[model samples]
Target chain A: MLLPWEYGVRNLARRPLRTMLTLAALSTVILLVFVVVGFIRGLEKSLSISGDRDVVLVYSVNSEENIENSAIAARTPALLAASVEGTQQRFGVTHVSPEMYLGTRVNTDENNGGLGLVRGVTTGAPLVRRSVKLIDGKWPSSGEVIVGQLAAAKLGYDKQDLAIGKQVVFENKTWEIVGQFAAGGAACESEIWCNLADLQTATKRQDLTVVALLLEPGSSTAEIELFCKERTDLELRALGETDYYQSLQQHYKPVRILAWLVVLLVSGAGVFAGLNMMYGAVAGRVREIATLQAIGYRRRAILLSIVQEGVLLAAAASLIAGAIALVLMNGLAIRFTMGAFTLRIDSVAVLFGCGIGLLLGVLGALPPAIKALRAKVAVSLKAV
Target chain B: MKTIANLSLVTAIVVLIGCKPSESKNENTKSSEPTGKQYLVASEPDDSTPVGEARKGAKDGDAVTLVGHIGGSTKPFVEGIAAFTIVDPKVAYCPPEEGCPTPWDYCCTQNEVKENIATVKIVNERGKTVSEDARQLLGVKELSLVVVQGTAKRDEQGNLSVMAQKVYVKQ
Candidate 1:
């Protein structure tokens, strides 16, 4: 005799439309969960990965903790050059970059313009940010520009538009896109970089916004804080780059919470649809279920069989959803006011989607299976 | 066997929708030279003190006239307030002869333009933010020269900014 599980599988074959409908619904829900969770994970990773523990940022006091609004005097860098005792030095040059940031509009053509943030960086910038790598062409010089792979996306430029020798117009001047770089999927990949002096002259703001310093292995923020304290003229605050990013992550806690709330709302609707399908399947198969009971199958075995079919359908949907998410959403750059971040569909997101699918299958199947089994065997068998 | 076929069909439909093309062909076009006439045309001449000179340690309550260009290409609107930056031409980090490639900001060069900038807050005689006129100035591009007459005041950081009564954009 065929086993009860095989019988359950056979029942699914008899009602192909019902089975297909249920599976499609479950898969759609699975995809929604994957996307929501993936978005949160990508934003967090983008911010956290941008910082280096050995590096520290110095910004002017009372700038509201916004690097864009902060300004340090022209002589600040020169003052801090030799004052900080434990600063890391490479090739006899101090490992410090006095950087500038500008929020602006970049346009490849009149129809393709968008908001972009550009960074004016020194030669030591790459040293301070070890994760950044020049993937093509050469480092920017003078009016030349080098864009990050994702930053180009935010500016409405595609892979070909950002190719070397292309020109993007901004601030009434043409900047040649000479190179492209990436900083390990960090937020820095949302900005274009050029020689520091060139950007300052363009915006006419000669003051450096912030200075990043690489610290010696044994050194800590205390040493740098002390140096800032001793100088009365340079009232600056020093924070580890990692700690700074952590604080920013905290600031965006509300946004992440909002994302989770959306996931719950959308997933709740999916669950209700799934429950309806399970109930309909059990009611339609009442006679089949009673026949199994009359033929010496235990009530518990009948319930298990019903549940097995639901679980199998859900599992199949989850697998397909995970595969689609991985191929489509992974590494897709999403833009916000601050910058752009790449979506990551890693194992965690995939597992989360599958887990929800399994939970829905069990919860949705239990109620209907128990109800179908509660009906009198004589009445169920006689009705057919 | 039929159950397997139905399941495969559902999966195929889901995959197709999820993997649909997101961007259009026209969205990824190449860079072309800037074209067309100026969007904002100036009808009158503007006269005021240079930004570099006005930023000098003027008395906190001193009234002054200032002339400079908006600094960056990004929307310089001060959120709820109606104010923006006015920068002296000489203060731009790039030398006038070198000419900056992007005029909205001068971040690509060194830190010599530190004292060559001033914020222009649009205010009425009552000193309240002029929300109406401020909204009208949103179309002004960065690096567009303009003139302002207002009171000079020092901010918490000792930077001088103007509380403007009038602003004249140099088209």
Candidate 2:
């Protein structure tokens, strides 16, 4: 007689200790996969969400967006506005914000300080980079500054460090903290923003570092290229905001690949550990299997029963691991050289975890199951 | 044993939680103040053209003289090098009535700040930073009017810059 599905389900409970060890190992592997994949996805999401596809970023020729190395003439923005075609205008004003980007030290206390990226921005800043939204206080002016929600934490500060009405020193000037902003988990959340001229004077860099432009709808990249060619005086190179971040994402490809390698190696260990547990279980259940076969259950039926138990254990463990990852890893701040991005453990990540768990159960049970079925019925029944 | 499984679970959880993210480890140790020393200052700068006009028509290799007030920083060249930004006096600054916080520059709430500025770097015959020549214009306070005479050169990248030969500042 064919054994009922309940028989397979109850078999895992027979060896509680071995089953728990195997489940624990598999669950750990699922957690590892979740973290690795989540990290890469988080970085990509942060960059993509932060930049608008319709905008273009113009930097000095042969330079990155870094302010220390790239020196642009102050007149370039007006020159580009008059020269470049397809630039969007808002309320009779051209949508152009010439900005300065720099990484400088920010004082956490009277005696201690840490590195922070500061953006020198004008009134058009909010229009150009629309992702930034002031959440706590007013926009910064003159000697006042606003910090991103993640900036304080990245600078080794606690919650109270960037509270409004506080003071922190930068550029050798005492800047009163006036506001805090959120950028929807964008990289801008790891920076400080202040008045354009204040930062320029403070850094002794009077020139604008880069010009960000909002292009009119239906504008093409050729327009930007033609603008750069016609105005040789500007000495500028234009990149779509999306392209700029795509290149940044490419820069971190190696790190993401390394994370996958780690997942593979760690999961390999889990698979082998699982295989060992199944081997022991099948050996101890050899007589039980022969008795089932003698009662007219086929070898295929016995094999299916063994594999089902392995998969069921993995599924149960996967649920536990998924819950744990959601609580601890989701929305966790992960800092990098440019800024910090949050780890997101969404439904997609959970589905990936479950898929890997299912694969482990199938592969880990196969060899042991085949070995158990190849045993002769009469000899297997008499063996142990 | 169940204890072994529990121990393994606890270890993995602890390890995952302990791997906290952090900012860049490369710390900036430089002081907040712009670094460098005072250069020489000059009294009674000579005949000059407005900085905005000088920037408009001056061709590459043309000997040009520009008169403008410093707009950005009051600090002397950090390395005693003769390089600074100058702005046209015609540009509007914050009036006392506006209660402007940054009186140093006109960019606080106004538009068109960039159209009035130029960079002046003084270099010797060897085309290197001339600390001696820079001294003649060093320590000149920000917003003080000055005259710079230099050979206008378009850099290989086509950016306009001045290789100043003489820089004079008003007392």
Candidate 3:
């Protein structure tokens, strides 16, 4: 027969201080699991969602994967709009955006500055980047710029520093923050955007970095690539937006692997710590266990009660960790080399964290319970 | 009741961890082979022009034979098409000791790469590039020397591409 459920539940209350210490230790470990898993998920989601299958990116062939280093003739966009067919058009204007992308130091004050991604774009950018939406203020004009929602985190500044009407210094010019935009959690959310003409004037650059084109339904990206091949004098390369971000995902695979390794190492350490605590907890209760066995209770029943006590503590710890992770870590902005993305404490992360917690409970209890039960009941009962 | 509830929750989590979402496989849309006469030739064409000279001199619809190595970029071959970029043999590739992963790209000479590379495509009667991989058809890989006989098609901006009729791969 099994031990009564209340027997195990009440046992956790018997040693309140020891139980609390175990709970705290288990909670800390699980919380770390939540954090690392959340980072992996957030980075993956940010890259995956940033790509649009219908968009084709056109940049200089020499630039390879780094679009910021790309330089193309300023007239390339006009040439593409005229030469390329099947591009999305509305009211006689083609969906082609010529953009200038660069990375430079951005300063909110004299002392606070960091490298920030900046983009110079025209009105056509919205047609190609459909995910972007202006949440506040208006489009940037001369001597003004728009900040993405996460641009402050990317530049290592407070949100208030990028507020509307505030001034930011970059490219040796001070610009007013005229607007704020969100890109559906894309990498672009870490960039500052301004008028193409103004940025070009500020940076003294005549060439463009890239030209993004939105294709109409039923159109294939092959046509754009064929254009790039035929216009070899232009020295251009064409890639689907989806394929570009997929390459970025491939580039960061090592970082994700390292994060997973951290999760594994942290879990291994937690299991070992759980084993030590469980051994100590079970070792002190030998007399009580022997008394219970002497009163006609089987060894199996005593073992089940000990395991129940462990699982109860673990379940409580998981609850505490889950609460703390959701409140403190969820939607937290983290800066990366590409940009800034928010920590995603989604359902998957919670499930993984809780699974690890329950696993620790079961594995920690079994060996100690089996070892304690191995001793003869008569000898245990006679012990002090 | 509480014990059963906790056990059920644990069991559910275990089951969920075991269950993975199925991956969606992308369907291959390319046909097995191009619909045309054989594009690979058995003999090398005589009086072949270098890629750099051809790019400068060949006019639209002019018959031309050019010889070059099969690489000018990291990805010299276009995906799902019988087309590739060839660089002039005179352009020196990066040495293996230089730690250049893709010497075929000739990364050491960017300006020369721009001036010496010509795109070659095998086209059908309809003037459309074939929907097949060039590597399989030509039996040539990156940095393989080959001779191409085709009609030169020049653009208004002085870019040169060849609609290839035959290709001879050197051993």
lDDT of 2 by residue, A252-341 (tens): 766876676676666666667768888899999889989989889888888888889888887887787888889999988777777788
TM-score of chain B of 3: 0.75
DockQ of 3: 0.26
- Highest TM-score scorer: 3
lDDT of 2 by residue, B1-171 (tens): 343355457657755664544454232112232222232234544567776776677788898888777653222122334565576677766665666444435546224434555667766667765543233435454565667777776545434556776666653
- List where candidate 3 sits over 4 angstroms from the true fold: A109-111, A291-301, A376-379, A382-384, B1-37, B42-47, B90-101, B109-111, B135-140, B156-158, B169-171
Write the number of the candidate with greater lDDT, choosing between 2 and 3.
3
> TM-score of the B chain in model 2?
0.58
Ranking of predictions according to lDDT: 3, 1, 2
> iRMSD per model?
11.8, 12.0, 7.0
Write down the lDDT of every candidate, Cα atoms only.
Answer: 0.73, 0.72, 0.85
lDDT of 1 by residue, A109-128 (tens): 53356788888998989988
lDDT of 3: 0.85
lDDT of 3 by residue, A222-276 (tens): 7678778778888898999999999999889879877876776676666656666
DockQ of candidate 1 against the true complex: 0.02
TM-score of chain B of each: 0.60, 0.58, 0.75
Candidate 2's error at B99, in angstroms? 61
